[model samples]
Structure formats: structure tokens, C-alpha cells
Target chain A: MVTRSFPGRYDSLAQIGEFIRGITDKAGLNNFAAYTVEMAVDEACSNIIEHAYGAEDQGPITCTCKVNTKGLTIILEDRGRPFDPELVSEPDVTGELEDRPSHGLGLFFIRQWMDEVEFEFESGNGNRLTLYKKRTTASTKSTRQK
Target chain B: MEITHTQYKHCDLVKVKGRIDSYTAPQLAETFNKITDDGRFKIALEMSELDFMSSAGLRALINTQKVCKRYNRGELVLVAIPGNIHAALDLAGFIPLFKIFDDVLSAVGNF
Candidate 1:
């Protein structure tokens, strides 16, 4: 597992993206998987910054990326208030544009992009969200051919 | 980050020229929301100058698209999407979600 610490703020999003990109590239993920994983990972991390940390400009957010033959797994642990992904819901897109809200789509996009995701909490500990993306057969084949 | 705006006959062309990360995304969203809230639906966003974008930026654009689509008034077209934004959109399966154009004029012309 590779771990990198980031400031719990929006600017740290770039650093988070770079970290995920490095891990995915080493995992032999192609541009497509790389992009998807990065997007999903960024969304999850953004949720932590915005919701977990309440967009506070203080504290540190840590991301641990583990890669193996199966695929890539990223565990995002933040030292903020515990958050329940269950209570998090997708935004309703069917409503009128004027009446619509700009939030709630981050997790929805994560669910759509990532192969699997789970959320957990450790009492006084901060929230930990795990996101996993398996290497597609096509990607594996391409890697083998290379 | 740099932003340039060009007004067409029926719409506005906003070119975002930088990384739309978590911090800048809200600014972009706010700019877009101001436009949409004022009932300007026929809009084309020129992203050729954009270098990077986080999921927050993607959410902002998607949120704008949803707003435009909801009014049933006009369309939100992405014009000259740079390679990085294209890659991001492709990964998120958003290429088919918005009408794409090669140039801002072409995107605006469609409206």
C-alpha cells in the first residue's frame, strides 16, 4: 500500500489526482481506467473535503492506494467527522432546473464510474471510504501484449 | 486560471482557461449558475484552454447541463474540449451526455 497525505482542502484535489494517477499507471491501467479511477477517487476525496471536513482549510487527508494482480484499491481516510455514505443520496435530476440543487451528484458519479465502493466508520475515528476498480480484460490483454 | 467570455446572437460563449479544481470549480459553477439562473440556456462552453479538472469541476458542468435540460429552454454544449477534459469526459461516460462541437462558433451556430 502506498500512502500520501494531503491538506484537507479543495486545492489538494490536484495532488490527490496526481497520486491516484501514479498508482494507476503503475498498476498497468490504460488511459480509460486511469481516467475513471481518478475521477471516482477525486469525487470520493472531494466528499471528504466538502462534507467530512466541512470544507475547512485545516487538517490533513490521507489516501492509501494498494495495487495487486486483481486490481487497484484506494482507501481514503480523513481525520474529520464520521460520515455515513448511506445517508448520502444521489441528487434528483428529474426536477426543474431552477429548483435543482448543485450538490449530491459527487457520490452518484462515483457509483457510476467505480466498479465497487464501500464506506465505514470507526467510532471516534474519521470516515474511511474504500473504492475499487478491477482491471478490465481488455486492459489486461493490452498489457500482456505490450 | 483565465476566463474569457464572448457573446453571440443567441447565446454566451464562456472559455475557461485553466485548471478547474475544487477551488476554481465553484467559481465556474457560480458563473454558470448566474447565467442559467438568469434564464440564459443557449450556452456553449469553450474548454480548449482548460488544462485540468477535478470531479468537482465535472459535477459543476453536469449540474449546469441538468439545469439547462430541465428548463427545456436551450442546450449546454461543450466546445473545443481540450485533450485532458476530453479524456476526463470519456472516462466518466459523459461524451454522449452533452452535445460536442469542434469550435465555439459551430456549437453556438447549432443553437
Candidate 2:
């Protein structure tokens, strides 16, 4: 298990990506799986920075990654405003192109990519978002061929 | 991320390379805004070299597409989307939003 904390700002996205990439690569996750995990974590962190901390608040987002036989697990910790994931409505993805909405896709993407996602709020710990992705044989084979 | 534009006969071709996350999505949005502002509504985004894209990138595309639709002149199309990016679009249920082609020339010609 490896854990690192970054400033809750957009600028830290690159570092977060690098951190995810290192762990996924070390764990031998295929490109597709690794990319999926990276994007999921990216969206999660972005939400914490934008929605939780808001633009005016500069907090710290701590990320911990663990890889085992099952798959990779990522935990994002932020001491910002508490948020309820269930309150986010599903995006109208089937809507006409002209009427498509943009704001809700981040949480949508996060839920779609990760195998499991759980959000918890603690009085002192703030918000903890845990994301999990399972490695499949298909992913390993596809990645090896690439 | 690097965005390069080329003027075609029927549409404008924008080729994107590198990752499109929260930090870089604004640049893409700016490029699309500039293209539409210049009255070039028929556009083809070539994504063969684009390595990765998050929801922020998707939002930029959706916003620009809305702009093109609002003008009633032409539409923005996507071309040569890589497998991962295409999967992301599919997962987000956004595949049907635009005309997607396998090649840039074909996408531009359709405009």
C-alpha cells in the first residue's frame, strides 16, 4: 500500500495520474485497466477539488492505492464540505445533441468505470471516497498483446 | 495536450494529442470555441493520437457540439477515436451524440 497527499487543486491532477500509473504498472495491470482506474480516480479527485472544496477552498486530498490479487483499490481523503453521492442525478445521455447537459457526467463516469465506489463522511476525517477495479483475464491478455 | 487545426474543403479538422483531463480540457474547449466563433461549424475532431480523456473533455465536446447545433449551420464530428476513448464515450452513453468516422478524411468529407 502506498499513500500520498496532494493539494486540492486542478494543478495536482498530473501528479495524481502519475501516481496511479506507477501503481497500476507495478501491479501489472493492463493498459486498459490502468487507464480506466486512472480516469476514475481523476474524476473522483476533480470532484473533491471542484465540488467539495470549491474554488475558494484549498484543502489537501490524500490518496492511498493498494493492489492485490483481486485488483486495485484507491481511497481519496479530503477535509472539505460533505457531499452525498446519491443526490447526483443521472445524466441524460440519450438526450439530443443540442440539449445535452455537461455538469453531471463526472460522477457518471466515476460510477461507470470503477467496479465499486463508496463515499463516506466523518466529522474529523471529512470525506473518504473509495474506488475499486477488478482485474480480469481478458484485460491482461489484451494488454499483453499491445 | 496539443491541438492542431487544418482547413479542409468541407470542414475544419482538429487533431488532438495527449491527455485531456481537467487541466487540459479548457484548451480544447477554447479551440472549439474559436473554431465556432470563426463561423466554422462543420468540424471533425481527429482523435487517433489522443491518449486519454476524462469527463471534463467530454463536457468540452458536449458544449461545443451544442454551440454548433445552436447555429443550425453544421455539426461537429469525431474521427479515429482510439479504443479506450471510445469505450469511455460508450460508458458515458455519449456515443450517439455525434457522427463518428473511422478516418479523418472520411469524417471531413461527410460534412
Candidate 3:
């Protein structure tokens, strides 16, 4: 498991993606899976920065990734204001695009991209978003080619 | 992040360059609102030069798509979408919302 802390702000969110990339690259993860990991991880971190902290730059956002032969498990923990991503309802994108709202789609996208996404919240403090992605044969082959 | 706009006969082409994360997604959102709020639709977003996009950026696009579609007078075509944006769109199942094109000319021409 590798762990790193980043400032919970928009500018600092980029580091979340880079950190996931660094770990996945060293773990010999496949390109597509690596990209998926990066994207899902980024979505989690962005949520912390934007929603959890409300773009506050003073707080810390920590990410941990545990890698095994078959897959990667990532956990993002933040000590910002308490929020539950799982509770946010998915947007009604089925209707006219013009009538859609701008927000409430981040967690939906995160769930869609990651193989599995779960959430846990601590009372009056913060929350944790856990994500998992299993490595595939094609991903292994792509990693081997690298 | 940098954005350049070019107007054609039928639509406007807005080219975005750089990362669109939580920090910059608002810029994109503001631009979209300013341009399309007046109900002038048929805008083509040329995102080939865009290198990165986080969930905030996706939300901005989704919001803009909704607004543009509501006037029901025009369409928002995502033109020359970069591989990264394409991946994001695919993950969000938003690839079907826009009429995608390979190049700026084709996208604008289709309008």
C-alpha cells in the first residue's frame, strides 16, 4: 500500500491523478485499467476538494492504494466537512439535455467507471470513498508489452 | 488553461487547451453559459487540444448540454474530442448526447 496527502483544492487535485498513475505504472497495470484507476481516483479526490471541502485549500486529502496480483484497491479519506456521496441521487439524464442540472453527476460517473465503489462516513467529521478495479488479461498483456 | 473561439457561418467553434479539473471546469462552464444562455445553440466544442478533464469538467459539459437542448432550437456538438475526454464521456455514458465529429470543419458543417 502506498499513501500520500494532498491539499483539498482544485489545483491540488491534479496530484491525485499523478499519484495513482505513478503507483499503477510501477505495478505494471494495463493502460486502460490504469486510465480507469486514474479517472476514478481523480473523481474521488475532486469530490473531496469541491464538495467535501467546498474548494477549501487548507484541508488535507489523503489517498491510499493497495495493489495485489489481480487488482488494485484505492481509498480516499478526507477530514473536511461531512458529506456522503452515496446519498446523492443520480441525475435524470434521460430527459431533455437542456433541462438537466449541472451538478450531482460526479459520483454517478465514478460509479460507472470503477468496477466497484463504496462509501463510509464518520459522524460529524469526514468520509471515505473506496474504489476497486480488477486487472484483466488484456491489461496484463498491455503491461507486459511496456 | 487557454480557450480560443472561431465563428463560422452556422456555428461557433470554441477550442479548449489544457486541463479541465475542478479549478478550470468553472471557466468552461461560465463560457458555455455566457455564449449559449441567450438561446443561441449549435456550438461545437473542439477539445482535441484538451489534455485532461476531471468529473467537474464532465458536469460542466452535461450542464451545458442540458441548457443547449432545452431551447430545443439547436444542438451542441462535441467536436474533435480528445482521447482523454472521450474516455471520460464513455465512462459517464455521455457519448450518445452529442453528435461527435472528427474535425472542426465537419462538425461545423453538420450544423
Candidate 4:
């Protein structure tokens, strides 16, 4: 497992992307799979900076990447405002453009791209977002092709 | 993200390169705002070099599309979208919201 902490600010997003790409690439995830994981992590970190911390540079975002025989697991922890998923509905992706919203899609993408997503929050502790991605023989084969 | 504008006879082309996530989406949004403020509604976003985008980038596109489409003044079109960025547009159900083209000439001619 490799862990790193970054300041919860917009400027940290690029560094976060680099961190995820490096680990995902080293883990033998295919380009598409690695891209998906990178995008999901970006969405998760963006949400932490936007909603959880409630402001930029307000706290710290700790990210961990662990590789196992099964797949990869990523844990992101933040001490910002806790978010209740129940209150936020799936974004109306199929809705008319005029009726579309900007708020819910980040969380939606995080859930859609990752194989598993679990959110845990405590009042004094922090928000822990755990995401999983399964390794596949297809992914391995494709990586070898490159 | 870097955005460069090329003004056509009837349409304005905004070449967007680089990744637009939560951090750089505002730059794209600000670009659109500047275009609309200039009363140029017909705009084409060239995304040939775009490598990645998240929902924040989608938000910027939708917001600008809404503004350009208001009162049927004009519309925001997309040109030469990369494979990954195209998937993001498709996933967001934004494929049908704006007219998409494979090249810049066709997209600019659309205006």
C-alpha cells in the first residue's frame, strides 16, 4: 500500500492525478481501466475539496492505493463536512439541458466508475471513501499488448 | 487546460486542449462567458487534443450550452472530440444536447 496526503485545494488535483496514474500503471491496469480509476479518484478528491472540506485548503486529503491479487483498492480520507448520499439523488443525465444540474454528477461518476464504493463518516473523525477496482485477465492481456 | 479562440465568419471556434477536471473547468466556463458576453452565440469547441474530463467539465459544457441555446439565438457545437472525452459526453447524456462533428470546417459551417 502506498499512501500520500495532499492539501485540500484545487492546486492539488494535478498531483493527485499523477499519484493515481503512477500506482494504477504500476499495478498493471489497462489504459482504459487506469483512466477510469484516475477519473474516479479525481471525482472523489474533487468532491472532498468541494463539499467535504466545504472550502479549498481547509483540510487534508489522505489517499491510499493498495494492490492485491484480486484488484486495487483506494481509500480517501478527509475531515471536511460529511456528505449524506441519501439526500443527493442521481443526476438527471437524461433530462433536458435546461433542467440539468451540476451538483450531483461528480458523486454519480465516482459510484459508476468504481466497482465498489463505500462511504463512512463520523462527527469528530472524518469521511472515509473506499473504492475498489477488480483486476481482469483482459486488462492484463491488453497491457501486455502495449 | 488551455483554450484558444479562432473567430470565423459566422461562428467562433474555441480550441480546448488538456484535461478539464474540477480544477480547470472554470477556465473553460470563463471562456464561454466571454464569448457570450461578446454576443457571439454560435461557438464550436474543438476537443481533438483533450485527454480527460470529469463531471465538472460536463457542467461547464451544459451551462454554456444552455446559455447559447437560450431564445434560440444560437447553439454550442463540439468538434473532433477525443475517444475518452467523447465517452464522458456520452455518459452524461449530453451527446444529443449539442451538435457534434468530426472536423472543424463542418462544425464551423454549421453556424
Candidate 5:
């Protein structure tokens, strides 16, 4: 498992993305799988900064990723308000555009891309979100288009 | 993210390059507002060089599209979308929300 902590700021989003890219690269995930993981993590962390922490630079977000023969698991921890994305009900994704609610889309995408998503909260600490993506055709395939 | 504008006879073309996450989505929304504030409703977004876009970015586009499509005044169309973003749009069920095109000229001509 590789773990990294980031300042809960919007600017750190880019760095977080780079970090995930590196991890996915090292795991030899296919392009689509890597992109899925990247997008899921980005959405999760961004939601954390906006909702959990309620603002930028207000807390710390630690991300942990573990890749094994079967799948990849990611756990994100934030020392902020407990805004558990797992509690956000699934939105009406395929409904009419006018009928769709805007708030839950990020979480929806996260759920769609990941095989599993769960949340755990500590009493005096903070919120933890875990996501898993099963490897369908991976283990040694690089994401490169060569 | 960088936003550049080009005015056409029928619509305004907004070229966006770079990631559109929560941090930068507001800027994109503001850019659309500027166009609408100028009394232009029809807009074409050239996203050939776009690297990334999250749900926040989708929210910006959908909100603007709703405004432009209100009362049949105009609509927002997408042009030259990247593959990954196309997949994102597909997964979000956003493909049916706006008219997408292969190029800006076709999108501009649709107005």
C-alpha cells in the first residue's frame, strides 16, 4: 500500500491526480481502468474539500492505495466534517436532464467506476471513504497506447 | 484551465483547454455567463484540447445549456470531445442533454 497526504485545498487536486496516475501506472492498469481510478479519486477528494471540510485549506486528506492480483483498493481519509459520500443516495442518472439533481453526480460517477464504495467515520477523528476497482484484464498490461 | 472566445455570425465558440474540476469549473461557468450577458445564447464549446473534466464541469455545462435552451432561444453544443470525456459524458447520461458534433463548424452551423 502506498499512502500520501495532501493539504485540503483545491490546488492540491492536480498533485493528487498526478499521484494517482503514478500509482496506476506502476500497477500496469489498462488506460480505461487507470482513468476510472483517477476520476473516482479526483471526484471523491474534491467532494471532501467542498463538503467535508466545507472549504479549501481547512483540513488534511490522506489517500492510500493498494494494488493486488485481484483488484485495487483506495482509502481516503479526511480530518473534517463527516460528509460520507456513501450516504448520498444514487441520483436519477438516466432521467430527463430537467429532472436530474446536480449534487449527487460526482458520487454517482464514483460508484459507477468503482466496484465498491464504503464509508467509515471515527468518533473524534474524521471520515474515511474506501473504493475498490476489480481488475478485469490487468496485472501486467501497461496503459500506454503502444 | 484556459478559456478563449471566438464570435461567429450565429454563435460564439468557446475553446477550453485543461482540467475542469471543482477548482476551475466556476471560471468556465463565468465564461458562459459572459457570453450570455452579451445577449448571445447559442454557444459551441471546442474541447479538442481539453485534458480532463469532472462532474463539477458537467454541472457548469448543463446549467449553461439549460439557460441557453430556455424558451428555445438557443443551445450549447459540444465539438471535438476527447475519448475519455466522451466516456464520462456517456456514463453520466449527459450525451442526450446537448447536441454534440465532430467539429466546431458543424456545431456553429447547427444554430
Candidate 6:
């Protein structure tokens, strides 16, 4: 288990990606799987920085990553306004190009890429976004490839 | 992200290098805005060197495409997309939205 906290700003996104990449590499994840995990986490953190804290409020987003035999779990916590993910209406992905909505793709990508995701708000914990990705045989095999 | 554009006969070929995330997505948006503002709607993005892209980047592409189409000008095409970035676009259900080509020449030829 490894935990790090970063300023709730867009510049910290690369630092967060680097941290997750290091852990996924050590966990024997393939390049594709590792990249997916890194991307999913990046989207989640961006949401927190933009939606939760807004542009005026700059807070700290603490990320905790745990790797085990089965898979990896990442928990992101931020002290900002909490909102319901359910209220975000799904965009019509198949709609015509002119009709498609431009926004709301961030949370959509997070849910699609990660194997599991959960969001919660607690009195002292602020907003906690948890994401999990399981290790697959294909991922392990790809990791062994040159 | 670094964005460089080359003007062709029918369309402009924009090459992007580096990661496009929340911070740098604005740079991409600015490039698209500049192209569309000039009434050049037929655009092809060469993304072989784009290492990473977040949803913000996706939004920039979508919004730029929308502006182009709404004005009855043209569309935005993609060229030489990396696998990981392609997967991101695929997962977002954006694979079918734009015309994707294997090379800049082919993409420009489509315009």
C-alpha cells in the first residue's frame, strides 16, 4: 500500500499518473492495462479538481493505492463539495455527430475503463472515489512479452 | 502538448505531441478554435505522438467537430492514432464519430 497527496490542480495530474504507472508496473500489469488504469485515475482526479473543488477553491486530493494478488484498488479523497454521480445523465453515444453532447465524457470513461467504481461521502472523509481493476491472465501474459 | 499545423490544399493537418489532459486540453481547444475561426473546417489531426488524453481532450475534439459541422463547413478527421488513445476514444464510444485514417496523406485526401 502506498499513499500520496497532491494539490488539487490540473498540473498535479501528471504526478498522479506517474505514481499509478509506477505501482502498476511493479504489479506486473501489461502496458495496455497499466495505461487504462492510469487514464481512468486521471479522469477521476480531473473531475475532482474541476467539479468538486471548482476553479476558485484549491484543495488537496489524497490518493491511496493498494496492490494485492488479485488486483489493484485506488482511493481518491478530496475535501470539496459532494455531488451525486447518478444525476449525470448519460450522453447518447450513438446519436448523430451534431446532436451528441460535448461534456460528461469524463465520468463515463471512468466507469467504462475501471472494473469497479464506487463513490461515497462521509462526515470526516469528504468525498471518496474508489476504483478497482482486476489482474487478468491476458494482462500478465502481455507483461511477459518484449 | 505541442501542436503544429501544416496547411494542405483542402484541409489543415495538425500534429500533436505530448499528453493532452485537463491542463493541456485547452491548448488543443485553442488550436481547433483558431482553425475553425479562420473558416477552415476540414481538419485532420495527426496523433501518433499523443501519449495520453483525458476526457477534457475528448471534449475539445467533440466541441471542435460540432463547431465545424454546425457551420456547414466540414469535419475533423484523425490520422495515425496511437493504440492507447484509440482505446480511450473507443471506450468513450467515439470511434464512429470521425473519419479515421492510417496516415496523414490518406486523411488529407479524404477532405
TM-score: which candidate is best?
4
For model 1, residues B5-78, the per-residue Cα lDDT tens digits are: 77776998888986776777888888888888887888898887776776677778778888788747887889
Q: Write the per-residue lDDT of candidate 6 for residues B21-89, one digit (tens) a residue.
A: 999999889988988889889999999898888888999999988887775779999888888888778
* lDDT of candidates 1 onward, in order: 0.76, 0.85, 0.75, 0.86, 0.86, 0.86
Candidate 3, clashing residue pairs?
Answer: A97-B66, A98-B66, A98-B70
Q: Give DockQ per model, in order.
A: 0.34, 0.54, 0.39, 0.46, 0.44, 0.50
Q: Show where candidate 6 strays beyond 4 Å.
A: A137-146
lDDT of 5 by residue, B1-111 (tens): 899999988899999998898888989999999999888999999999988898999999888888898888998999988887888888888888989899877888888
Native-contact recovery for every candidate? 0.29, 0.65, 0.44, 0.46, 0.37, 0.56
Q: Lowest-scoring 10 consecutive residues by lDDT in candidate 4 chain B?
A: B82-91
List, residue by residue over A1-146, the lDDT tens digit for candidate 6: 99999999998898898899999988878888888889889988988988888862479999999999988999999998885899898877887887878888888887876889999988766799999988884274332110
Report the lDDT tens digits of candidate 3 across residue range A1-146. Answer: 88888877777766677788898887677676677677777777777877778867758888888989878888889887777665798876565555555677677777876778888888765888888887774254332110
Estimate how well candidate 3 is docked, as a DockQ score: 0.39
Docking class of 3: acceptable
Docking class of 1: acceptable
lDDT of 5 by residue, A93-112 (tens): 68876786777888888888
Ranking by TM-score: 4, 6, 5, 2, 3, 1
Across residues B1-111, which tens digit of lDDT does each residue of candidate 4 receive?
788998877989999988888889999999999999999899999998987888888888898999999999999999888765676677778888989898998998887
In model 1, pairs of residues that clash are none
Clash pairs detected, candidate 5: none
Candidate with the larger DockQ of 2 and 5: 2
Candidate 2 lDDT tens digits, B1-111: 899988876778899998898989999999999888898889899998998899999999888888887748888899888888888887776788888998876887787
Q: What stretches of model 1 exceed 4 Å from their correct place?
A: A93-101, A137-146, B33-41, B49-55, B62-75, B81-98
The true-versus-predicted C-alpha distance at residue A22 of model 2, in Å, is 1.2
- Strongest candidate by DockQ: 2
| Residue A97 C-alpha lDDT in model 1 | 44
Q: Candidate 2: where is the Cα deviation over 4 Å? A: A137-146
Candidate 1 per-residue C-alpha lDDT over A1-146 given as tens digits, one digit per residue, 9 for 90 to 100: 89888888877787787788899999988876677678777778777877888866757888889998988999888878888878876666555445445566678767876778889888777888888888874274321110
Q: Sorted by DockQ, highest first, which candidate order results?
A: 2, 6, 4, 5, 3, 1
Off by over 4 Å in 4: A137-146
Tell me chain A's TM-score in each of the predictions.
0.85, 0.91, 0.83, 0.90, 0.87, 0.90
